[model samples]
Target: MQLPDPSSTRHPGPAPYLRIATEEAFAPPEMLEIYRRILSGANVDPGFRGLMGFYMSSPSERAQHIMRCLTDMDALRLKHMDDCGVDMQVLALTSPGVQVMDKATAVSFARIANDYLADAIRRHPTRFAGMIAVAPQDPQAAAKEIERGVSQLGMNAVVINSHTQGEYLSDTKFWDIFAAAEAHDAPIYLHPNSLPPGMYEPFMEAGLDGAIYGFGVETGLHALRIITAGVFDRFPKLRLILGHMGEALPFWAYRLDYMHRATVKSQRYDSVKPLRRQPSDYLRENVYITNSGVAWEPAIKFSQDFLGADRVLYAMDYPYQHAVDEVIALDGMTMSPEHKKRFFQTNAETVFKIPPR
Candidate 1:
């Protein structure tokens, strides 16, 4: 099949990065309808303008708005791949996963979401792959869903929001879900959703909130909690993915490392093993970062330097950022061709087990 030409248009640089993140494409119709209603003044919430402004000002706004119908999954995958110069995309259900629902409801939604995603991959094997959306609210059910998604659906990995409703992933109750993920050898993509209650009040007070502040703060803390909890020590082979430039973690790696190293009392957690290594070490070894909403040269280079090029992947954070602009931004960077290739494609392939084209 003939894929779309990425270089057809004249741009400042090589075509921007081809996005593979979940939110851009997998936004369920129901979610978009809710967003539309909110945007159209139906809800008129106090935070509506801030939310819309962020969405409109994102670098990949055009790509982010394209929602796929459940029945047209194959066409959507092909069209997205062609338009974005994406050779293969690892799919996952959009935000919050099935975590918000009760145990039974979460299990049902997860089966439906995974089945739908698997069907998309089945219809276009070379163009798409999938991640299981499990409900962390119930560990047993979450494990079952992970097993089903990986064994039956053939999903490559799992995608989860930083926290479920209000609970962070560090809780012991969620260990079964992690164990299943580790057993299946599927990485978990840690994307951010809304902040838990009271968490964003400080940002709200400053009038700089939502994705600009809240999302990063919330997700960063979540990632840190996993590191501090020594979850990686327990599941050393488990790979975790962070979107939007590691959700601000990369920029603060040095400080985090220093703080962790300099304070002895702080190092004493309830875990069996001590955090002998810096937080950045775990980030480099066990975690992967993506260039989603962030496209600046300095930020990308800094993240690559800290996490290594092999740990970075390209993401557009679609609907929130424009894919075209993201590609344009990366193309303009002065990074080596090999590094760029890894960021655009190879790293994701390795992490998600996507067969190379």
Candidate 2:
């Protein structure tokens, strides 16, 4: 499908618009070598092996560009943001980061990345905001970093990619991460990653492992688990940011509530009692979503209508979507001007408590 060039469609003659993007990503220099080691490791699973091959299949010039984009914060990144008409970005570590590492490696590297991001934000206060990268594998350390990131480093949000090894955030052991977020009122931006081998073996070589099928299914399931596991009840203030337009959950929303009620009411569920609230309630109240990698207008409209526009924010899913003349494409969407304002700007500010520019 053909689309308009975002450059041509961007806000004409920029009157200093405050477009605070909630989900553009970057990988720190310290974490880059760690990933190279992981990727080059011999024991990497077959499904992941295929996904890595797909990304690296890009010609040499593009691969070089991807590496530079992953580490650079000042020159090319800022220039692209300017070109795309993005006034500010809430930057995060790209996927398969600390989640794949052993606890010691994950802990030390999480600090390094978070510190890099914190320093970057300090240097360019107006241009960037940072999300803390905590290693979920170690809950105490993760909680400590959350406090350090928020109170000490001036970071505003937290990001944990969907799973660590095979464990989801819904597991009780990870509740400290949730508690940290609620205590500080920091939103946890749960990004997607490739599925683990056990769950992904069926789609082994069909190219269904990463972003296409695996990310949405695994992330959506993770979100549902958080809801059904009574996570919201424990920490009502804990808010989550789900990317890729709620990972296709908004469309099937009502059915989730209905079906969940039907099964639980019928004693099909093993738990003695059903959830105090319907699943949809948790999604609406505790979750916020970003139109990052997926920018389809219909999906954006549905997310706004279903989840409330206040809970939806704009992002470019950078480096991946980094030709961000593509970022301006969101300007072409046919929403009310008011909705557009909230989508691109205010919602992010209010949600992240970003001080005015």
Candidate 3:
């Protein structure tokens, strides 16, 4: 999988409207050090060991370049955005961000990272918007941090890097985080992390534990778990943003609805609880999907058609999987000017509450 070089293509100048790229990621410098320390310690997550171990230690040009881009919230990132004609980027702390740390470390680092991002946004108000990073390791403290982020820091959304340790957000222990998100009306961007242990070893053995195929599998499962667990029924107003084309959920909507109904009716598993609506209903009504790392026109169009036009948005998946040519490809996608506007700009504005430029 060769990545596009932003330097290879000429900028297309301006577009019909502001181009806001959601799902962009940045890391505080110290976060890298923390990851390094974790990699050297015992009881390391196998998925993290596979993903970050490679990125943090590999000397390949791609690894080095991505590492450089990840820590830079300033010039280099801005340059790529400018070169790609992206008007704004909605930044979130990079994956496994403080999630693998202990409760005390996770809580404290989450606040520090949020403050770091808030300051960056303050400096580049028009260029950057941010999502709140919270530690689900301590849901109560996390809920308070979410409030502080939205109320005091002017952040637009909450970013949960899929799971904590090996636990998904569907568990009741993590509901406080959802409660906070719903109370503030802040969308939770359920970004992918490396797969959790037990389920991750096989994928890692095959070298599929990163973004290639494992991420969608892991994150899509997390989204479905929330739906099947009646999280939506519990907090009907909660909004979720799933990247990588809703982790391929739109394509499987009908199957999910059908199978979920069958499973619930049979009570096959104690956890297979009934819901007020079908699984896909929650997707249509409560979730938003982004074309992050997915540059194909047919897939993007299908996602919009299947999930409703307004529920689809654009994201660069910056630093990790971005290219100027990919931006050009998206620009040339066949859609009505109005729908295109929603896909590239307005949908993100609405979902993330991004202010107009």
**TM-score of every candidate relative to the true structure:** 0.81, 0.92, 0.97
What lDDT is obtained when candidate 1 is compared to the true structure?
0.70
Name every residue pair that clashes in candidate 3.
none
Candidate No. with top TM-score? 3
Tell me the tens digit of each residue's lDDT in model 2 across 1-357: 565454354442363247777887788766766666777888875544565444545567756666678788998988878877788989998887788888999999999988888888888989998899999999989999999999998887899988788898878999999999999999999988878777787655666766777788888888888888889989998999999898888887889989888888788767424777888888889999998777678889988888898999988887766645555557777888889888988898888878865
lDDT of each: 0.70, 0.81, 0.90
**lDDT tens digits, residue span 231-291, model 1:** 8888888888888888888788889887776564565644523575778889989898887
Which candidate number has the best lDDT? Answer: 3
Error of 2 at 186 (Å): 0.8
* Candidate 3 lDDT, 79-190, residue by residue in tens: 9888889999999999989898989999999999999999999999999999999999999999999999999999869999998988989999899999999999999999
| Residue pairs of candidate 2 with colliding backbone atoms | none
Root-mean-square deviation of Cα positions for candidate 2 versus the true structure, in angstroms? 2.4
Better of 2 and 3 by lDDT: 3
- CA shift at 55, candidate 3, in angstroms? 0.6
Candidate achieving higher TM-score, 1 or 3: 3
